[model samples]
Target: VRQAMVLTNNPDKLRALAAGGVEIAGRQALYGSLNDHNHRYLSAKAERAGHWLDEVLDTRSSRD
Candidate 1:
């Protein structure tokens, strides 16, 4: 059997943003901002990957 984490909960797909790696609004060049305008850019990728943006966003908010 696979081992699970003993300290915290895990999400469907765990990902690490890494230190100073988050770009939420042109604030950083990595993602070039994550505001409304630049946010929709993920729709296509998410659709292709068959992922739910709502669920992802909800999860982020809850975690924060």
Candidate 2:
């Protein structure tokens, strides 16, 4: 299934799927903020939930 495949490939999508399907608001919420708050939240989700957040995680490490 395309939906399942997409979900498997994308951690954000997986989360969206789990949270009663993805909506426009979900997309906006994810990219709405680029501050530490959103960054940390995304990092935690990646580490704890196996989300594909390499781009954000890599940036965090580089900043250190």
**TM-score of every candidate relative to the true structure:** 0.27, 0.43
For every candidate in turn, the CA RMSD to the true structure comes to: 13.4, 7.3
Q: Name the lDDT value of residue 5 in candidate 2.
A: 31
lDDT of 2: 0.56
Q: What tens digits encode model 2's per-residue C-alpha lDDT throughout 1-64? A: 2233342425556566657554323222222334676887877777887766676567667877
Candidate 1 — worst ten consecutive residues by lDDT sum?
Answer: 23-32
Clashing pairs in 1: 24-34, 25-34, 26-33
Every candidate's lDDT: 0.37, 0.56
Put down candidate 1 lDDT per residue, 1-64, tens digits, no spaces. Answer: 1222222122223222222343222111112223556455555545665444554444445666
Best by TM-score: 2
